[model samples]
Target: MTAIIHDAVIVTGDDEDTVHYGASIAIDGTRIAAIGPNAELQQRYPSAERIDGRGRMVMPGFANTHTHLTMTLARGVFEDLSPPHKPPFSGGLSPIPLPDMTQDERRVMAQLGALECLRSGVTFMLEDSSDIDDYAETLAGSGLRFLFGERAYDRTGTAIGDPAPFQLDRAMGEKHMATIERTFAKWNGKADGRIRIAISAWAPDMCSPELLKDLSALQSKLGTWITIHLNQIWGEVAAVQAHRNRLPTEYLADLGFLNDKVICAHCRCMDPREEKLLGDAKVIVAFNAAIAARRGLSPRIDSLERQGCTITMGSDNMAEDMVEVMRTGLFMERVRREDGRNPTPEQALRWASRNGYKAFGMADGGWLAAGNKADLIVIDTQRAHLVPMLRAVSNFVHNGQARDVQSVMVDGRWLMRDGKVLTMDEPAIVAQAQEVANKAWSRQFKKRFDKPPAGFSPAALP
Candidate 1:
């Protein structure tokens, strides 16, 4: 079927960063067939389905390159806690443990995350998590493009910044490797290539040297994408120094794991030397700004970009809104470099869209072009806050809310239209997620303590 979204402001996130005031995008099957002046395209595809794009801004959908979708359950619980970063390092990234959930409940939570992504105009994402097989089908059914990373780590450290002894659980490592292979075989290229698989070692401090070597070899053998948390916190940095006698980037390099196919998330604690090393390797850095700011940290994004590393944005934990991620990224970088004029909204938009797609190996996506994939979003510009849209992209970046998203199209199909998700039951998913999260947190607190954290309250289970 052919459809034409006509008569809107088109923000072509192409190499030239083109913008069209009254343009139309013609979608033929799963690819954009044409893009040009609205009247011209309307005549060109006269018989196609016409989607009135009046008072809307059509742009390539945002790509969230790094996030843990299932961690949506921890939204209110973990955001306020600050993990220790001092000499007496803690064993984990957070004090609260991950709440336990049944497989069905986990599926509901994953779908809830997908719902938020759709509502917020994210068409693509890279999700790094353990046991992705549990909700792979659920995510696929949500009609969003995904790269699922089957995470594996042998270290028994409870949290990410654990300075405990690194025990080599070879058997467990092998089992995880097998799980990765199985997950890839089962889910890679599923949903007509909308779903892909990747390799993930949870963190530098959580994986042993031998396991890293094996994972690198496996990555090369399979020729798949790899992602890992790198130098996320000061404790993690100190732990790696104590164990490997080298920085995290150097350790990954020694294991032959720092390369273009790898995406390093949360490089917030890196030094200039490590930045140079990562840049030399040409790896993509997932500059997860929202979570970084919540954790009271920010990466040297400008320096990393200057060093030839591609800067992509991710929502990380607790949230899946790429809009928030993009804006936060811009603000954080400006504050970090003390240059408000540099790293403009246009650059931040590219990082959130184009760079993210490139990191996930989608060469023709995350941009609006004739030959590019038809993964885009339409934001209603008729809202009061979005009025006087003198500068479309800049205004959208600084003032737009997720509620302004009017439609989401993926692979030439409207996954969401007129602010309604067509692929899943949104209200049902949200209600179920709330119920499941309450029970899960209640179970965790009852199993461990009588009181919840300060300023935190889990909904009482009925």
Candidate 2:
């Protein structure tokens, strides 16, 4: 089916960062067929289905390069809690513990995350999690492109950021390696190539040298992409230094894991030397700004970009809103460097879209251009806050919210239209997520403490 979206402001996130007013885009199947002035396209595709784009701004959809999809279950509980940074740092990423969930429950939770992604205009994402086989099909069915990383690690006795001795479990590493292979065999390139599989060693501190070497070899063998959490927090840096006698980036580099195809997430706590190493290796850094800011941290994004490392954005934990991620990244970097004029909105938008797509191996996506993949979003500018839209990209970047997204299209299909998701039941998913979260937290509290936690009544569970 052919569809023409006409008479809107089009932000083509191309090399020149083109902005076309009163423009139109034609989509044929899974690719963009043509783009030009509205009147010109209207006459060119006279028989195409017309989508009125009046009072709307169309642009490339956001790409989230790092996220824990099922961690949406920990939204309210973990956002406010973070690992201690001072002396006597525990080896856990968060003060609150996540509730154990069954495979079916995980699938439901992941679906909930996908619902948020579609609503928030995230067309593509790279999800870092273990045993993704459970929810791979469910996520693929959500009508969003995904790269699922089957995460593996050898340090199992303690959580990340714990100040305890490192324990390497070779058996656990082997099992995870096997799981990665199985996940690739089962889900890689599924959903008509909308779903791809990648390799993940959970974190530099949590993985042993042997496991890292094996994972690197497996990645080369499979010729797949790789992602890992590198120097995310002070505690992680300390742990890696204590165990490896080198910086986290140095350790990974020695393991032959730092390369162009590797996407290293949360490089917030790194030094100039490490940045230089990553840049020299031509790695893609997943600058997860929202979560970093929430955790009282921010990466030197400008430095990394200047050093020749590609900068991409991710929502990370607790949320999946790439709009928030993009804006937060921009603001955080500006504050970090105290340069309001540098790292403009257009650069941030490119990082959130095209850079992430390139990191995930979709060079043709994350941009609005003829012959590019039709992964784009339409935002309704007919809102109180978005009025006086003198600058389309600037206004949307600084003042826009996710609610302004009126439509989202991926692979030439309307996943969301008129502020509604087409592939998933929105209300039902929200209600189910609330129920699951409440029950799971309650059960966890009761199981661990043998009683309901303060302010949480057991009677609330049905």
Candidate 3:
């Protein structure tokens, strides 16, 4: 299939921070064939299907580096609890244990999360989903790029249901390994290399050292990625410190798991040594600024960049909007630096685009250029927030939102066209998700009353 997008302002990351006006891009199958002025491309490929890009700013679609897709079912389910006031890791909301999730529930939740990603201009996602045997099957036809990391834990009573400590017995380990192998064989490199599988060990506190070591070995043997929740909260950090007498990053490093293939979701509490170790290991930090702000945690962007760690954007919670992630990242860095001009708009754009592909191991993606993957986003420049566009890129970082996303394409295929989804039926997905959520909520009516005497209303089940 050949696609030619014409008459657009192209934000091509081929050059450092450059946007070409009155340009066009030609996609031959999954790769970009040419990128130049519209007149030249039209002359070159006269018979190609023309996609008029008038009044649009075309850029690369976002790569969400880290997320828990199935957790979409828990969005509002735990917001109203008494805030974790324990010192050190003393903030952020907690999710209610949802042991009642069936395969159908898992499918619906995964679809809902994928729907949110599509709507929010997310071209790719790295998800840490639970131990649902059919997780990949549930997501098989969803038509979004994904890296499904099958969750692993060896702690007893830690997962949602068991009254005793959470532990993965040998039988459970074999089951998890077999399921992951099958998932990898089925979904890895599917949708034209848009999907893959990873080995996910929840956290140091959640997984035993032996399990962590085993996971690292399997990740290396399978030549896939490893994702872990590292230093997300202060409690996790404190627990690691007490157990290993080292920071979480240092401990992971000691285990030989903090390498380039590892995408650590949040480095909210990383110190100088840990930052250096991450950079030395070439680990990418999935900078989820919005959810971090919601939980009162922020990344050390400047320091991380200085240490040469690749930082990419992600919407950790159901806050699936990438524009909000970009805006939050820009503002949060400035506020943290206490200087208005700290993180330049150009830098913010890089984190949201090019660096995102780096985190996803898609070096040829997140850029608009010849020979790159045609994962593009077309923004409506005519919108109110985009008007008076003296500086397009700067305005994008400062004022843009997801609704400004006019179109989206992944692997040269039009997943969305002119602000409408094409791969999935939006109305139908929403309706089905709402029905499932309503039924799930009704099943446990009093599960709602466990809310704090003083706090926000509990998040209803999805």
Each prediction's whole-model lDDT (CA): 0.89, 0.88, 0.76
For candidate 2, write residues 1-462 as lDDT tens digits: 889999989999999888988889999999999889888888988899999988999999999999987899888667777886566778777655788898988888999888888888999999899889898887888889999999999897788865467887999999999999999999888899999999998999898889999998999999999999988888888888888789999999888888999999999889999999999999999999999988998888888888889999999988999889989998998898999887899999999999999888889999988899999999999999999988888889999999999899999999999987889988988888888888888777667764433455453333
TM-score of each: 0.98, 0.97, 0.91
lDDT of 2 at 309: 93
Give candidate 1's TM-score. Answer: 0.98
The segments of candidate 3 whose C-alpha lies over 4 angstroms from its true place after superposition are 77-85, 88-95, 132-135, 159-175, 445-449, 452-462
Candidate 1 yields a Cα-based lDDT of: 0.89
List model 1 lDDT by residue over 1-462, tens digit each: 889988889999877778888778899999999999877887888899998888999999999889888889988778887686577887666677778889998899888888998999999999898899999998898889999989999886366776677766778888999999999999999999999999999899889888888899889888898999999999899889888889999999888888998999999998899999999999999999999999899889988989989999999888898888898988988888889787888999999999899888898999999889999999999999999888898999989988999899999899999988999999899999888888988888878774577766536422
User: Which one wins by lDDT: 2 or 3?
Assistant: 2
lDDT of 2: 0.88
Output the lDDT of residue 429, model 2.
Answer: 83
